[model samples]
Target: MKSNTPRMPGRPKRQDQDMPVQETVLFTASRLFMELGYEAVSLQQIAKACGVTKASIYYYFDGKPQLFTASVSAVLERARTSTSQILVQPLPLRERLIKVSEAKLARSHGDFETILREARSSLSQKQLDEITSKEEMIHDCLAEHLIKAMDAGEIRRTDPLLTAHAFSAVLMLGIREIAKGTPADKLARDIVDLFWDGLSIR
Candidate 1:
């Protein structure tokens, strides 16, 4: 089995001296975006959640566009961290891939997924570009591991990027059903089984 190594991300952006305040705003925005949708979530509403004034939010971010982007990006970073931990373990390629999918499925239930579906209406072109790049980095990480496994013959040889996207798509679909009362463990296991068996078939 090919052992995959985790890639360390670039240096963290230094948090503002007022990081606690920015984090609170981000927290409030993330939850509200999930519940209310981005269009319905006003700066005043976010301020109310953070126990601050709308001006305070503006001091941290230009507007709702940046707020939503920062909030969802935080969640994606968390998911990326979880995936990094999963990849570092000495496991078979298939098992490592399954674990990565399950980690992402857990994250899918959070506010970011809702924000992702809704943020396009609220974010600016710059904000959209930044968030898209962050998400694309995560996809690239998965594709990298797949390529390594394929080269080592630990899994079927396939288009690495396409397989990575397919793996992500299946997990996202499974997570949507899992959110609606299908047990997460059962759904994850069944999805892994389907992927494994399908790969095994000629």
Candidate 2:
């Protein structure tokens, strides 16, 4: 006995099937790791979340470490791409910096430092280096933009990489529990303003 209800109209239900299998696995792993951190989330969980069997996960990754490395590397690569795009815009250096900070602060990600610290023993040297390399690309991209800003007299000359690192540190500071209730934009502005005071031409 067929019911008289009509099926929902939208992109076909097979949209899930259309997602590349490896991509689905990596994305699921990334979210789980972000939400639960490395030690807690398991391959079984990721496989279940991806709607694939555990063997299917093993087919794509040798084990948890490989999958973790791939997921983190993918995250960092995407970050670098987005950071590069934002910094390349015509906005002023301070505005771009604020935009970058606001963009990152608005997004939810696990505490990367804590997660890496927790997972340090599990990650191989090569995998660690790969992750570090991917992370540095974002810093290096920001540094390049900063050097240009310095040369243009938008900010006074300073060590570009160190300044880039400092900005990131301030962002980290702004997101911690102490600043929990502050709006992302206000926090970003406060940080950039404090930063600009230091770098502004005397």
Candidate 3:
């Protein structure tokens, strides 16, 4: 006669067990790439950070170029989603622009200039084009919203594409202010006030 017995749970599952290895690698690689720049980071470093092997990384990505592109793409996708949400708010155009600027500044942590410069050497032309295309999509999204605001007479009529580019540049500059310990709310207001003073239709 056999006695019925409940099987004990094996080792407790790790909190990250539910996450796929590829996703883990992507996230870890993105942080490393941002912190260390593209050329300075390596698959071995990422693998160790993710608690996996270099071969495991290769299983998910072809090489460093592919991983770097994927990591940057992940960041852009997140920024796109956040920008979309901010743009869709029912706030006034100026307020929406401020919020968007704040969001962009909040997300700008990496040494982007280094990443972009280094990526050109490591990434293929197609990969470089893809990155540029993603950037253009963000610009185009802003431009589309600017065009709508102009049509509504909420702001002065201007070249939406050029205006969008200018707005993005100004917001990028705000990152320096953030580094200087200026509050994001204050920076946002200052940026919007300065931009509106010039762009607003009296």
**Top-TM-score structure, candidate number:** 2
Candidate 1 residue runs with Cα over 4 Å from true position:
1-19, 108-117
Candidate 1: residue 24 lDDT (0-100): 85
**Candidate 1 residue-wise lDDT, 115-171, digit = tens:** 576767667788888887877767877888777777777778777778767777778
Which structure is stronger by lDDT: 2 or 3?
2
lDDT of each: 0.72, 0.84, 0.81
Over 4 Å off in model 3, which ranges? Answer: 1-16
> Candidate 1, TM-score vs. the true structure?
0.79
Ranking by lDDT: 2, 3, 1
* Model 1 pairs in collision: none
Give the per-residue lDDT digits (tens) of candidate 2, residues 121-183. 999999999999998888899899998998888889899999888888887787673236778
- Using Cα atoms with residue i matched to residue i, what is each candidate's TM-score against the true structure? 0.79, 0.88, 0.86
Q: Please list the residue runs of candidate 2 whose C-alpha ends up more than 4 Å from where it truly belongs after superposition.
A: 1-16, 177-179
Whole-model lDDT, candidate 1?
Answer: 0.72
